[model samples]
Structures are given as C-alpha cells and as structure tokens.
Target: MSEQHTYRVIVRGVWDGLSEDSRARLLAEVDDHGLTAMTFSEEGSLTYDRALKHFSWRFTVVSDAADGDEMAAAIAEDRAASALAALGHGFRDLRSTVTDLDTMKINYKGGRR
Candidate 1:
C-alpha cells in the first residue's frame, strides 16, 4: 500500500476583513498546529466584493498508511480540526471522503457543513 495522504480545509470569510496582524496570527496558529501542508485560494476581486465574499484554505496532511494503522488518519483529522477551531475560525468536520492505501482526504469548511 502507498504511504501518502491528503486533507483539504476550506475557510470562508472576508480575508480582507482580517487585518494583516490577524492574518499573520492565523497562519502562525496553523503552523503551530502541525499541519503537513496548507494552501489558500481566493476568489477574484469582483467576487470578493460581492455580498458573500469568502476564501478557501486547504490543508493536506501526509502520513504513511503502510506503516501505521487507521488511527493515524483519525488523529490527523482531529488535530487539524482542533487547530482550526482554536484559531477562532469556524471548523466543520467533513470526514474523510477518500480512504485509499496510504492516502486519506478530509474536507473542512468554515461555514455550515
């Protein structure tokens, strides 16, 4: 079995509403939470200007499935969820949709699940 996993986390909100300092604090908190990798995607300015402006942040946590048990995936997911929640950013648990060997992908959004 392969030994790789991926997870996605979506954060929706006015990215611009957050001050630069707050942004930095959020990023630092994420890092402190120990996520393997994280990426952010922002809609175009026009969309950002819309009433429902929002942004998405994805987190990918890599682990070795072949060397570990299913618990690893659960732990990763729990940790990610806790981390985001700790940052005061809404964190919705989207459970793992894909559970391939060495790969587990979980999705999370800030708003309602």
Candidate 2:
C-alpha cells in the first residue's frame, strides 16, 4: 500500500499583526476542512519561528492518483483567491514557498522506506 504523504503550505505577504478575531476567522476558513487537506506536518513546526510574516498550513493525504507537488500547488492556487479576499488588501502579493514534494526527503533520515 502507498504511504500517506504530507504537503506543506507556506504563504507570504499576508500582513502581520492580524487582530485576534480576524486571525481566528481566517484560520477557521482556511483550515476547517483539514480532512480535505493534508495534516499539519510535524516537520513544518520549525517553519513558524522563521515564518512570522507568513503563515503555514499542511495536509497529510494518502492518494495514489495525484503527484504530491502537483497536488500541493493545486491547493495553493485554489486558496490564493479566497485568501487574498480574506486578507482584503487586494494589492498584497502572495508568495508561496512550498518545497516541491518530489524532492522532499521523506524517508532519508535513516534509510529508504
């Protein structure tokens, strides 16, 4: 059986200092359907301290159909429009920085899976 895969979603250019209410609403809207998306990667935890101006989301999905990076990029595109609306600046550019899943070292820590 194929293993589950994790996809990291990193977005930049969202203005910092969001109000608690705004942040919560944004979080809910973007993350409520976590089951539809992949799981938050434990590997992505470190991304936060360095990702202040940006935000990260993740999805862990098990699918043999779609290629990982392609799936990740598709999620990025699907969310970009709504995310821009939520941020409400209209002019703030979004910069996505997901490590291509194809090159990700999934099982390299000790040995191949």
Candidate 3:
C-alpha cells in the first residue's frame, strides 16, 4: 500500500487587497488540486513582523510514492506552487508527514523552499 501525506502549507501575501474575483480564483485553484481551502487568522497586530497576508492549509493526499519515486513528490509540490502563483501569492513552507500504511505511525519532517 502507498503512504498518505498530509501537507501543511503557509501561504503569505496581500489577501485583503485582492478583488473578490481574485479570491475566488485562488480558492478555485486550491480546489483543483483536491484541497479544500481553509482560513487563518491574522494572529497578531496588523504591523506584525513582515506584515504579509497569511493562510494555513491542511490537506491529505495519497500518492504511489516508492522509496525513491520523486515524480509524485515533485508533481504535488509543483501543483501546490502553481495554485499559489495563479493568484499572485508567494509559496512559503510545506511541512508534511508520511504515514506508513502498515506501521500506522506518523513522523514529522522538515524542508524549507
């Protein structure tokens, strides 16, 4: 059985400035990738560090990823980046954990891009 991947995405940009249509387009792109969009609060002052619009997403996806089959990972990463770029937003970090079907264990991993 293949593993399931849960991706935590932090997208930062000017969300308040975007037009309604732009917002819809952005969510639509997210939906296209089978990811149901979620919301994120400002969490601090308007002038908080860097002061960019931010949203957090959580979605689970499964791919036929073998030990070294990078195509699945690469495709998933590209699709996510494209979804963000379509709305003129910046793609930050994507933290994911792989759950082995047999072992049923969750491990946290990291990578910055």
The numbered model that scores best in lDDT is 2
Q: If ranked by TM-score, best first, what sequence of candidates would result?
A: 2, 3, 1
**TM-score, one value per model:** 0.30, 0.36, 0.35
For model 2, what is the alpha-carbon lDDT of residue 96? 55
lDDT of 2: 0.47
For model 2 the local lDDT of residue 93 reads 51
User: Model 1 clash pairs?
Assistant: 4-102
Clashing pairs in 3: none
Index of the highest-TM-score prediction: 2
Q: Tell me the number of clashing residue pairs for each predicted model.
A: 1, 4, 0
lDDT of 1 by residue, 1-113 (tens): 67554333343334434545555665655443233333322210111222223433333445565545354445544654554455544434334322343344467768975
Higher-TM-score candidate among 1 and 2? 2
Reference-based lDDT, each prediction = 0.41, 0.47, 0.40
Q: Every model's Cα RMSD, please?
A: 13.1, 8.6, 11.9
Off by over 4 Å in 2: 1-4, 14-65, 100-103, 106-113
User: What ranges in model 1 sit over 4 Å off?
Assistant: 1-57, 67-69, 99-113
Model 1, position 6, has a per-residue lDDT of 38
